[model samples]
Target: MPTPDFVLALREHVGHDLLWMPGVTAFVLDADRQHMLAVRRADTGAWTPVTGIIDPGEEPASAAVREVAEEAGVDCAPLRLVDVRTHPPLTFPNGDHAQFLDLCFVCEHTGGEPYPADGENTEARWFPLEDPPPMNDRFLAQLQIVLADRPEARFRR
Candidate 1:
């Protein structure tokens, strides 16, 4: 996948000084509660929820909404914060090492259908929440926790 122009510039200018910012990811559930919006990432083909790094001056919830719109062409309202996770410091394929604190929000889809927003995603689809495609273990675990009646279960590092 091609890096966004802004991200490429940030890496070039900041080099190792680039920091991992906290981000918010949204699992947008349809009104009927039968489907969840997900994207097929062009880079990895990894099926994941709408996600993006929080802008320097943006709040997590707002980032979630903006990412959903930008990535999936959908408008959403955060229903509740489902999980807050901090991944161990790691490097991306491009050798950028950083730690990410991710706030996963359960969101209600307010408008728009699934449409891949150009470079950000290759495909966007509404998958049955009950039978999501295989995903990373971390995300699958988080989804299980969020789906349970108790949405506040915490995962320890």
Candidate 2:
């Protein structure tokens, strides 16, 4: 489930060539907005908001909701798109290279308990907004944006 079938098909043809892909990150807050859900990635062991590649023809908001549920075992309703940015290209340990246009959404947890529901993550839990597990600069910045409670989405220009 980590790599989509479409992406796998493309990889079969292109091998390790760089792929430009659309991705989504969901910062899901509890109903009271005091806790944020995070997952420790299986690959990197870093705690981050729920993130996944957007499937072909999928709506971004729906993708965010789906990723939150799939990764964290929690259903969520995307409140708003919080940020859009193109991340720097990355090469996985397996040598597949890709760059992502990440669309970040601030979502409200609607149901279900959080756990690492998918094999992609090793742990999943809710953390206090004031004291979350350490994350990379990109995710940290996105968290700050969601915390600011902005009504409008940020677009990197």
The number of the candidate with the highest lDDT is 2
Candidate 2 global lDDT: 0.93
Instruction: Give me the runs in candidate 1 sitting further than 4 Å from their true place.
Output: 1-14, 151-157
- Return the TM-score for candidate 2, rounded to 2 decimals: 0.96
Over 91-133, each residue of candidate 2 has an lDDT whose tens digit, in order, gives 9889999999999999999999999998999999999999988
CA lDDT, candidate 1, residue 14:
79
Best by TM-score: 2
Candidate 2 wrong stretches, greater than 4 Å: none
The sequence of per-residue lDDT tens digits that candidate 1 reaches over residues 17-114 is: 54676878788889987888889898888999888888777788999999999999989998888888887888777777668889988899999999
Instruction: Report how far residue 69 has shifted in candidate 2, in Å.
Output: 1.2
lDDT of each: 0.82, 0.93
Q: TM-score for model 1?
A: 0.87
- Minimal lDDT window, size 10, model 2: 65-74
TM per candidate:
0.87, 0.96
